[model samples]
Target: MKIAFYGSSLVSSYWNGAATYYRGLLRDLAARGHDVTFYEPDAFDRQQHRDIEPPDWARSVVYPATEEGLARVLAEARHADAVVKASGVGVFDTELLEGVIRNGASHAIRIFWDVDAAATLDEMRGQPDHPLRATLKQLDLVFTYGGGDPVVEAYRGFGARRCVPIYNALDPATHHPVAPEPRFSADLSFLGNRLPDREARVEEFFLRPAASLPDRSFLIGGNGWQWKELPANVRHLGHVGTAEHNAFNCTPLAVLNVARDSMADIGFSPATRVFEAAGAAACLITDAWEGIELFLKPDEEVLVARDGQDVAEHLRALTPARANEIGEAALARVLAEHTYTLRGAQVDAILAEEVGQMRSVA
Candidate 1:
């Protein structure tokens, strides 16, 4: 199948969190003999900070962030067997969402893949005329980043024909165990681009914990934290590229996963960092959220913290041997049950079935 995906940057993880999700899922689909062309707009200095080149697995098209540029891409999308308009393209999103369906081949399966379903749903609730609300009914299927039953029901309520949660999974080839590097060495570390929904949580879950444990080394790696004051024991490394993520994960005593306000509240939504940390065999300490057990068992495969105090306590009680045990157990579970190979197969089957049904109707 030839699939055209309109999404955030695949070549850059700069300010875009969905980069790995696009690479892992689309790379797997390509490995299964499907052709994928990922269309990303050149915006927010992402092109200037690309972590990867155009990969062999998928054709990467970087278009100018202009109406003319969008038109050219829409023309190219018409030939795909499946046209996916992912949420949060960061430029002309409504045009792409409606354009893929309007310009695509009649036989092509139109999909709206939401990388942030929780936030999108919130927007729709606040605004009755949300563009996606009308587009939902026209889309053949809605694929969420990862919000189990609640997201499915919400999209269905908004008039989606079908909705599925494609949870984040490890791309073992891209992310795995690596030798620890001294530069990233820390008692606990968190890597995520600083954003509004995440700022308060990062303060409570990461910064607060760092302050409580004055003796422990802490690190923050991501963009937009240049001016924020930090505790004496904490280090801020601005914008660690994707190439260094494994080292960042491996060198920390235990990596932290702090969900955005919406994702934590929505539950069942695991960010790409969760799997990336697990794949690198890093003991993970995630802020408390519902449905965590569905991915990694709390207190065994991962450490769950209800607040900064819990995080501090976990750190105080953690031993090197215990961290290794949790890391290995988490790695084993993800390798067996949550790799992209399995996810790709699931999506492949769904595409085939959906296409076959379209053909039958014709």
Candidate 2:
């Protein structure tokens, strides 16, 4: 099957958190003998800050952020067996969503692949005129990064034909244990872009804990945090590249996972960083969210933190030996169960079944 994925930049993780998820899943899909082409807009300075070149596993098309550029890519993508319009493309998303369905091949499975389902669903509910609401039922299927039953049911209520949560998973080839880098070393570290939905939680889970333990070193990675006030002990490293993720995860005594406001409330939406950190066998301390056990068992495989206090206590009590033990446990669990190899197979089966059914009906 030929798959055309319209998403944020695939070669750049700069300001684009979905880059790793796209690479891991699409690479897996390509490995399964499917032709995969990724079409991303050259917006938000992403092309200028690409972390990796166009990969051999998948064809990458970086289009200009203009209507003409979008049209050219849409013309090329119309023939794919599966055409995916991912959420948060950051440029002409509405046009792309509607365009794919309008212009794609008659038998093509038009999919709305959402990296942030919780947030998207909230928008749909709050604004009846939301662009996706108009196309919700027209899409052949909706695939989410993660949101579990709540997201599934909500999309169904909104008249989606089918909705599946293709939860985030680790690509061991991309994210695994590496020799710790001195710059990322810290008692506790967090890497996430400072966004409105996530900043409050980051402050509560990461900054507060850093303040509570002034003597302990804290590291903050990811872009847009350079201006934010941080504790004297916390070192801010803006924009950690994808190639350095393993080292970033490995160097810290513990890595923190803070969910966005919507993701935590909706539950079951684990960010890609969770898997990346765990894949590196980093002792992960994550904020409380439902369905975490489905990915990594708390206490043994991961450390669950209810609030800033919990994070502080976990950091204070964590021994190097205990951290390594938990990290190893996480690594074992993800390698065995939560990996892109498994996720890609699952999606491949879903697409095959859906496409088969559509063709039969035709």
Local distance difference test values of all predictions, in order? 0.94, 0.94
lDDT of 1 by residue, 164-251 (tens): 9999999999899999999999999999988999999999999999998999999999988878988999899999988999999999
Candidate 2 matches the true fold with a TM-score of 0.99
Model 2: per-residue lDDT, tens digit, 188-228? Answer: 99999999999999999999998988899999998889989
lDDT of 1: 0.94
**89 in model 2: Cα distance from truth in Å?**
0.4
Please give the range of 10 consecutive residues that has the lowest summed lDDT in model 1.
134-143
Give candidate 2's whole-model lDDT: 0.94
RMSD of each: 0.7, 0.7
lDDT (Cα, 0-100) at 307 in candidate 2: 97
Off by over 4 Å in 1: none
TM-score list, all predictions? 0.99, 0.99
In model 2, the worst 10-residue window by lDDT is 74-83
